[model samples]
Target chain A: MEFQEAWPYVVGVYMSIWAVLLIYVIVLQNKLAAVKRELGSLSKAVERKG
Target chain B: MKKSSLILASAGALLLMAGVYLAFFVAPDTVVRIDDRELVQFSQKIFYFHVPVAETSFVFLVLGGLFGAMFLGTRKRSYEQMSYAAVEVGFIFVLLVMITGVLWTRAAWNVWWEWEPRLTTFLVLTLMYSGYFVLRSSVQEESAKARFGAIFSIIAAVNVPLTFVAGRLDSLKPVHPKVFTLQGASMEGPMLAAFLVSMFGMLLFATSLYIMRLDLLRAREDIEYLKEELEVG
Candidate 1:
C-alpha cells in the first residue's frame, strides 16, 4: 500500500497504544491517591480513639 | 521500595521512548506489490510495538497463573493480590494487542476482523481471563473470592497456549506472520534490532507497572487493616 494509505493505520495503532497506557496509569494514580486519603483519615480516627 | 520503583519507571519510560524512535526512523520499511501496484507497507511498523506488547501480555498471564497456584497452595493474601494485579495488567495489554492487531489486519488484509483460528482463539483467551474479574466481584466472602479467583486464573491460563498454537493447528491461512523461529527472526538486521529493543522496553514497562500496582494494593490493604483497628478502638 502507499505510504499515505498505510500511515493512518500506523498512526492509529501508535496513538491507541499510548492512550490506553496513559489512561491506565491515570486511573491507578487516582486509586492510589484515594487510598492515601483514606489511610490518613483512618489514622486520625485511631489516634482520637486512643 | 518507592525509590526503586521510581527508578524502574524512569528507565522504562526512557527505553520505551527510544524504542518508539527506532521503530519510526531506524527500521526498514517493507515493500509489497499486488496487482501491478507497488505499495509500501508502512503499517508494518506497528509490528514492533504490537508483537512486544502481545508477548508481554502472555508473560503476565503466565505469571498470574503461577501466583494463583501459589496462593491456592499457601492460602496467602499476598499471593492472591499479586495474581490479581498480574492478571489485571495482562488484561490491559491483551486489549491493546487486540486493538493494534485489528488495525494491522485492516491495513494488510483489508478487513477489520476475521474468523481465523488465531484471532478466534485470542478473543476466547481474553474472555476467559475477563471471567476472572467477574468471578472475583460476584462473591461476597474474602476467602471464597480469593479461592475462586485463583482457580479461575489457573484454568484460564490454559487458553494462552491455545491462542499461540491456533495458527499452526490447521491448514487455514493466517495473516499473522510467524516472525520467530528456531533460526531466529525472518526480518532484516535493523528491523530485528528495533523489534528486540521494543520488546525489552515493553517488558520493563510492564514489570514497573506490575510493581507499582502491587505496592498500591498493599497500601490499600494496610489502610483497611488500620480502619478496622480504629473502629474497634
Candidate 2:
C-alpha cells in the first residue's frame, strides 16, 4: 500500500502525541514561573515583617 | 533541566526518531489475513508508538497507585506528591493511547469506535482516574484530600487488571491483538526490533518526565512550607 493513502492518519497520530506533550511541558513551565513569583513576594513580605 | 536528565532526554529523543525511521522505512510492511485475503497495512506502523505509549501509561498508573498506598500508610506529603505527579503523567500517556488507538482502529477495522471489552474497560479506567483529580479538588482539607486520593488510587489500581483481562477472557474474536506472550512476542525481525527500541525510548521519556514533574511538585511544596514558616516567625 502507498504511504499517501495512510499519511493523514499517521500524521494525525504523531502530531497529536507531540502537541499534547508540548502543551504539558508549557503548562509545567508556566506553573513553575508562577510559583517562583509567589515565593519571591512571600520572601519580601517576610523580610519587611522581620 | 539537570545534566543527567538532559542527557537522558536527548537519548530518548534520538531513539524515538530512530524508531520512527525504522518503523516507516527499515521495517518491512505487514499484511493482515482477513476473510481469506491478505491486505497490506500501512497503518500498522502506528503500532510501534501506540503500544509503547500504552504500556508507559500502564506503568505510570501502577506506580501512582503504589505511591498512593504508601502515602496512606506513611502519611508523608512526598508520597502524595509522587502519586499525584505519576497520575498526571499517566493521564497524558493515556490520552495519547486513546487517540492513536482510535486512529489505528479507523484505519484497520474501518470503524472509529466500538463497544469492545478492552476499549470499554480502558475507558472506564480513564474515567475512574479522572475522578481522582475531581475528588482531590473537592476536598479542602489537606489530610482529607490525601486520604480520599489514596483510597481512590488503590481502587483504580485494582481495576487495571480487569481492564487488561477483559479482552482476553473469551477471545472468540477480539479486535485487539494479543501480541505479547509469556515466552516471547509474536512479531519478528525488524518489526520486533523497532518496537523494542520504541518501547525503551518511551519508557525513558516517561521516566524523565515523571522525575521533572516530581521535582516541580516538591519545589512548589517547599515554597509553600517556607511561606508558612515565615508567617509563623
Candidate 3:
C-alpha cells in the first residue's frame, strides 16, 4: 500500500485490464467448445443420412 | 514449429535480453530535477530499450490496421489472422512501454502518471486495439465478424496517426501539437546497440506469440471444418 502514494491508479487499472482480457479468453473458449459440439451432432445426423 | 518462425522468435528474445543487460547496467543515469519540486530523469540507460520498442509498437499497430483493412477488402482469412496477430504483438510491446514509461516518469517527473499527450494517445490506441479483439469475439459467424472487424480496423487505422499527432501537438494553436522531441540526448555505441537489440527482440517476441496463437486458431478452424464435412455426409 505504500506504493499507492507513488501510483494511486495503477492497481485498479491493471486489474481492470486483466479482467477484460480474461473475459475475452473465456468467451473464445466457450465459443470454440460450442462449435465443436454442434459439429459433432451434425456429423451424427449425416451418418444416418448416408 | 516452423523453422524460420522459431529462429526469428528465439533470436529476438536473446537480443532483447542482451539489451536489458546493457540498459540497467551499462548506460549512465541522468536526473533532471524540475523546479526542485520534481525531478525528471533523462537517463541514457532506459532510453536504449524504451525508445526503440515504443517506435516499433507504432509500426506493428499500423501493420495490424493495414491487415485488418485488407482482410475486409479481400475477405481473406489469412489477412484477418495477420490483423489479429499484429495487434496482439503490438499490444504486448505497448504494454511494456507503458509499464517502463510509468517508472521513468515517476523517477524523473515525480509523477506516476500524467494526462501527457503521448501517454493519453497510447492509452487510446490500446483501448482501440482491445475493442478490435472484443469485436472479433462478440460474434460467432465468421464472415459477419470479419466484415465488421475489417471495417473497425480501417476506422481505427485512420485514427492512429491522428491520435499520435494530436498527442504531440495538443497545445500549439494552429501548430498546437507539442514538439517535444527526445530533447534529452543522443544515444551512441553500446546504448544504441542495446536499444536496437531490445526492439528486435520485442518484434521477434510478438511474431513468435502471433504464430503460436495463429496455429491454435487455424487448428480450431480445421476441426470445425471436419465436423461440417461429417455432418453433411
Q: Which structure among the candidates has the greatest lDDT?
A: 1
**lDDT tens readout by residue for model 2, B14-97:** 888889999988899888688998777888888898899998899999999999999989999999989988888998998898
Give candidate 2 regions above 4 Å deviation.
Answer: A44-50, B33-38, B171-173
**Model 1 per-residue lDDT tens digits across residues B132-197:** 888898999989998999899899988888788887654767656788876877999988888888
**Which model scores highest in TM-score?**
1
CAPRI verdict (incorrect, acceptable, medium, high) for model 2: medium
Model 3 per-residue lDDT tens digits across residues B92-141: 66776677677656644567777766677777877887898898899999
Please report the candidate that would top DockQ against the real structure: 1
Give, for candidate 1 chain B, the lowest lDDT window spanning 10 residues. B167-176
> How does model 3 do on interface RMSD, in angstroms?
7.1
The positional error of residue B26 in candidate 3, measured at the CA in angstroms, is: 3.6
Give the count of colliding residue pairs in each prediction.
0, 0, 11
- Listed in order, each prediction's TM-score against the native is 0.94, 0.92, 0.71
What DockQ, on C-alphas, does every prediction get?
Answer: 0.68, 0.52, 0.11
**For candidate 3, what is the total of clashing residue pairs?**
11
lDDT of 1: 0.86
Off by over 4 Å in 3: A1-50, B31-44, B170-185
